[model samples]
Target: MDGDCKTAVVTGGTGEIGFAIAHKLLCNKGKKVVLIGNDTKKGSEVVDSLNCSFGRSKATFYKCDITNREEVEGTMKKAKNDLDEIDIVVNAAGVWNDVCWPNEMETNLGGTINVVLSARNHIKKGNGVVINLTGLSALEPFPNSPLFASFGAGVIHFTRSFGHDVNFRRFGVRVVALCLGITKTNLHVDLDKKMLTKEMGKGMSDFLKNACYQKPDACACAVAELVKYGPPGSVWVVEGSRLFYYDVPDYKECLNLVSQFM
Candidate 1:
């Protein structure tokens, strides 16, 4: 977090896991943390608390809805002016519409794109890192979230392959995606309800019960560690257990884990 580490921009920092990561970066790593979210109440509260808990460790909050491209861009401008440069962008901001299917994609996918676009400009010469949070459903589809599954899948590929399309190496930016499994975040509640009424909803409910989720502090630890151990194209899965990479065993283990829910 210190000594030339990039400034950390955590989208959705007002939320559960995002808050955890922001605190970890500040309290543990001493990173310059700027938390971005739309909830002024919660956002300001978190900033105030951080000022108390971590003694202001360069942590601030900004009002932004990542789904708004213009707002995201503007926020980036302000952030750059405040921090000078952005070294890491964590796309922890996510959404799921309880009443509709496609809104899931609109909120999650659209928001991610806006964050990535804004964050990309500040990353330089293999220095900046983008860590994205994707749900287990990104790979393990639930019938209730058909469109969400499709959109998440697209994001997975996009994160892994976008480097090839862009000159990140020349620019010194590293973009990696974190495929998160079942975690007890605010998103989990809405996701559980959205899929629970579907044809396969019953099993998903049971799956939720059996799942293990640590405190948001634990998740923050994992991401911070990954940042210390990353380059372009790095991927990690932060589950109840230790962090794991994407590979054959990951798919198989997750497949077995998926069976219990299906």
Candidate 2:
């Protein structure tokens, strides 16, 4: 490992966006990437693949559930020991399962609280980066998605407001939320086509299938760029195959642009 290669921890790293971000970090900038996820077997596989693909940068997978505050603290401690000084944290740990209990808040909201609280010190120590991902459902309300809507909305508000920017400024950390429209990922594959059609109404299925969604690998690359340059509270929206950048000041302006498309 290069002494200067910044260490980045990515939650849900076995998934497409997470894996793509790790791969891009390793292959593009030789960043030491540590993947955190519950699926030890698949997560280890991603680590192996990155090792083979980019022998320059080091990659490893640690089994930790971000929802567990203890596990998050333990993982952060171990990762700090391994890397010396943590630089970036990608809070990608999320679950869409709203049909069963209150797992949505427990997993999504709890995981974020853990990730931010665990890495609080690192952000204070040096110029750190945090990227939280949200979805279009965040901006709009859906009828049947009673579960995910609130969580998505919470993520958006947390990343945009909720003292996140104040902390970034106070501690020299860069925390931003990337609002993704729709992407190609295994999670989408799990959704029943019929269910989507039923939930989104009839024509929505075709609209989704033909949507010009960005690939996971590409979004990952963009995230690495964000880590390098994007500022705090900057909401990045990648939609219809075009990457758009919007800050709070110009949000009204950007919102107007969005209205144009709508």
lDDT of 2 by residue, 50-98 (tens): 8888773388889998878898999998888777778888887777655
lDDT of 2: 0.73
CA RMSD of each candidate after superposition: 6.1, 5.7
**TM-score of every candidate relative to the true structure:** 0.85, 0.83
Clashes of each: 6, 0
- For model 2, the superposed segments whose C-alpha errors exceed 4 Å read 1-4, 123-126, 162-165, 190-207, 247-262
Error of 1 at 59 (Å): 1.7
